[model samples]
Target: MTDPTPGRALPLEGVLVVACEQAVAAPLATRHLADLGARVIKVERTGRGDFARDYDTVVHGLSSHFVWLNRSKESVSADLKDPDQLARVRDLIAGADVFVQNFAPGAAERLGLGADDLRRDHPGLIHCSISGYGSTGPYRDAKAYDLLIQAEAGLVSVTGTEDHPAKAGIPAADIGAGMYAFSGILAALYDRERTGEGTTFEVSLFDALSEWMGFPLQYAAGSGHAPVRAGTSHPAIAPYGAFAAGDGVEVVFGIQNEREWERFCEVVLDDPGVATDERFASGSARVENRPALHGAIDAVLAGLTGDELVERLERAGVANARRRTLDEVLTHPQHEQRGRFVEVDSSAGPVRTLLPPITFDDGRTPRMGPIPDVGPGV
Candidate 1:
């Protein structure tokens, strides 16, 4: 939709945000708002700025994660511990439509940036706090990281092979908290328009990840046991995983229901009778005999190349995909077909990034601006 405000202003053009944030979750959330046209002013500690900027020197001598999350933001250095800095923040917060802070519980409050204190001064300012844990409860003060949250939330327990659990390759918990914080800010912004009153929003890494664990939690509670850690395999379905092809490539495939099972047995496995075999007759039964069923399908796939097997599976109305590495995915045909890539500028120079997944009727693409530097720009 064309922004009703005109002049091609982004969705949040006139909004002013002040973020007292560091690290991944909060910065990522505020950065996205900046991308959508908010004037984001990131408040950082004087001298070194966000510590995440020095977490690594991998992306053209910059922290890869920092550059990716802190783009399109202006930086202002202020020591929250100092009276002058605190006063300056109050001044900034007074004018801000939204104020974000990801400091630990009590930290923002100690510095007088707590949502309650700030809201009293600026009744219409939306205050958001992103923390490792919420303000209350026993574990609220516990140090939490993405991997730690994943483990605490039981994601690790079901992710890897049966013998050993592994953390997800990406920072799922951090990303989840960030996304929630971003959406929470948006909701608060909308509410302010109607009520003429601002609200406080809080997102914790542990809480965000815990909500995501509901499926496995319910399954374990109902089943009277934990879900099996079937690496690259589904817990509730059979013959749903990757298999080796004759050309030494791997292809992942899935079967959702009885219809797909029938199609697989008849076309892919070339054995219609296998569909009605007592041990593999139903979804639950197939899951019980997954080993035998997988072996049967593997034997057939062993004779066909990965490309040929995928083509045949698609023609038979089965879902199948080839597993590609990050490098391979960069130049994948689907990216060009879907126009998913766009060029973005950074201190390191220009880089290509995947565009936002959403498409518009007017086809006006969002901007891919530069990642800013420390000291002066976030």
Candidate 2:
């Protein structure tokens, strides 16, 4: 079906982005630019195209990752090793407002696609480089995939249960880097508007993830102890985890302050006395006495059905959510009500995707254009 909402004067309508990217980070960055109505020309390897296209055949014969990240952009094929094809890509970037790449460390420079190399000829072009690690230090050349960066950035250390360290279910490092690169490009674009000069910036998966690991790092530094993994529970708060209702459905909630705790006790548990108990009076005390606190809360919750528990939580002003599976989330009421799903054409066929999270004051959503066919501009 044709998009019901189309052409509402997007802000980045005149911007152009040329990307030499594969996998997650760089593609994700340019995808956002494309969503905002920028023209993004994604240059992939010849014949094979982006390897992510083969990550899986889950989306109408297209890889889920490729379908997710490559929308609203044109795909071209280039053999960077070939001088003629490399020159063609260079010519494309010379006229582009933004250039993004996530080649392995030193690989861009070897291909003469490095920021410094390009900026020498196209001084007004914004160049963004995304890598596993920044272009410096011993770890610069280290193979940095999402899992490796998660481990190296100390994210895995604070994730999962204490017994078993686990990487995030999603590519957190790659997403973080992508978001930063996206913002950096926007910033560069804004600055160019004022100064009429393009700028260069770099985003590393390790650095991006390290910024996100600040909470655990600061907690460890201040207390001279690392935060322990608490499985589904909050390490610093009591009764702030998943609890099963009488129907065996899980409801996750957190108590941020004593006022909320008192409200939760009186309204949800129907026992105001639990809030005044010396052992669980304060947030710190409740955390220190988490075992007994959870036992008490679960005792009350065990008598209520999931719907009844959630209704009570809503009435009591408690922040709570149901533990939903991925499939459940696809049919989530919020998404359905907000009309978050949109369909875009792909090489395989049409596919449904979520609209971009941002909504302009004018009520115009980002234009999610089509996924391109490989070598469309070869």
Indicate which candidate wins on TM-score.
2
* RMSD (Å) per prediction: 2.3, 1.7
TM-score, candidate number 2: 0.96
* All candidates: TM-score: 0.95, 0.96
State the displacement of the C-alpha of residue 62, model 2, in Å, after optimal TM-score superposition: 1.1
Q: Report every candidate's CA lDDT.
A: 0.85, 0.90
What global local distance difference test value does model 2 have? 0.90
State the lDDT of candidate 1 residue by residue for 115-205, as single tens digits. 7889898899899988887889998999998988998889999899889899999898999999999999999999989999999879999
Write the residue-wise lDDT of candidate 2 on 1-378 in tens digits: 233246556888889999999999999999998888899999998887999989999898889999999898988998888898899999999889999998888898999988889999998999999999899999988998899999999989988997998889999999999999999999999999999899999999999999999999999999999898988888898878899998899999998888899999999999999999999999899989988998898899899999999999999999999999999999999999988887998868889999887777766668688888787545
Give the least accurate 10-residue stretch of model 1, judged by summed lDDT: 1-10
